[model samples]
Target: MESKTTKKVTRGRPVCEIKQAEQKAKLIFSAKQLLNIKSYSQITIRDIASEASINSAMIKYYFGGKENLFVELIQSIADEQFSQFEDLGEHKKPVYLFIRRFGEILQSHPGIVHLLSEEVLNKTTPLARAFMAAFPARVSKFLPPLIQQETGISDTKKAKLAAFQLITLLVSPYILKTLRQQAWQIDDTEIQGEAWAKDLYRHFIYGLKESNTNEVES
Candidate 1:
């Protein structure tokens, strides 16, 4: 149907394209699963490609290698996170429900805290510093003021601190997980663990009010 040179080039491109797409998908899936279990330093391009069943070299061809892949993964997660926030922002979700959602998000994306803790929050990497710089501004815009508006806390400082404490409560599970990995094993997402989290959430919320609020405490 075409000249020899043209046919060779045309056929080659499609094969390359298909291979590229497969490699990309493999890397993405592998990263997501591995991220849930290990720290970033423990993750390698070779490991990802091997897990994805592709040549390690293919990772470069498709995702521009490990750093870009990590950035892309963060962006994908941020997009999904913002979408969840948007959905919640539209509803008058109960305080404990909102707290539970924060925990659930962190639980499902355990790697976020691990990475953020190691890199940005820990001053371990310049890349983490860059990510952390914008994180507070972004989170502040949506969380604290929103909490104040919802709970009628006119004190801006208190509202912001409350929001941070709430996130800390949500994040406590991951912290516990990291600590326990050194010795004891704890599953913060388990029913017993979740009940404790709810109690803490309710306990903390009580302090944000004038006199009365949810008495549910851990």
Candidate 2:
């Protein structure tokens, strides 16, 4: 008697699905590279597609549109950085670690800093509003506790303020990169690496400690 023959079915992603994922990733990467070179208003969907060497329709199909793609790109970057802070609350030196990591991120993606600065200054675009709302909420949530731990500022509001101040100090140099180079002769190499981060951390901590001492004296 001839036995029945059975066929096994594979239970993984189909070839088309894998191809789609690769295409999407390429689009995202190309968008990021273009963002570093051009402003949001200046970059077009065709530009991203061309940069990725894919069809423009793919971007629309994958991300809905240029604006949505931009939002997704920024969201991905933010998620990556925030994920690194998962253990921040439990860190022995949260402030130092945070500063060092932040510096590294900015150095790695100076274009993101520039893009955010432009969006913030404009304050009229949907991207700007989305970023303003989302970014600060995350900062307020994770950073205040870390700031409290580091500075002994028991009040949440004060701790948040301190956190904001520290962020400002870390971000200002990057945002003012052109001005620093043109006027002050400070180049990117001098202002962006581990050495720069160390100096910023020391200066900020010293100033904060001095302020706390003055408050106690008063």
**Stretches of candidate 1 exceeding 4 Å from the true structure:** 1-22, 124-126, 129-137, 178-194, 211-218
lDDT of 2 by residue, 1-218 (tens): 99999866433222488788888788888988988878877889999999988878877778889988888888888887778888877878888888888788888876678677887666868777666655666876887788778777666776778889988887888888789899999888887667777788788777877777787889
Model 1 root-mean-square deviation: 5.4
User: Backbone clashes in each candidate structure, one number apiece?
Assistant: 0, 0
Q: Which runs in model 2 stand beyond 4 Å of their true positions?
A: 1-15
Model 1 agreement with the true structure over 1-218: per-residue lDDT tens digits:
87566334432223666766766766787887888889888999988977887777766766677877877677666666656665556666445556666666676787787787765564745456545543444666678767776677777887788888777766655766667555666655452346866687567766677422432231
Worst ten-residue run, lDDT, model 2?
7-16
lDDT values, one for every candidate: 0.67, 0.79
TM-scores of all predicted structures: 0.74, 0.85
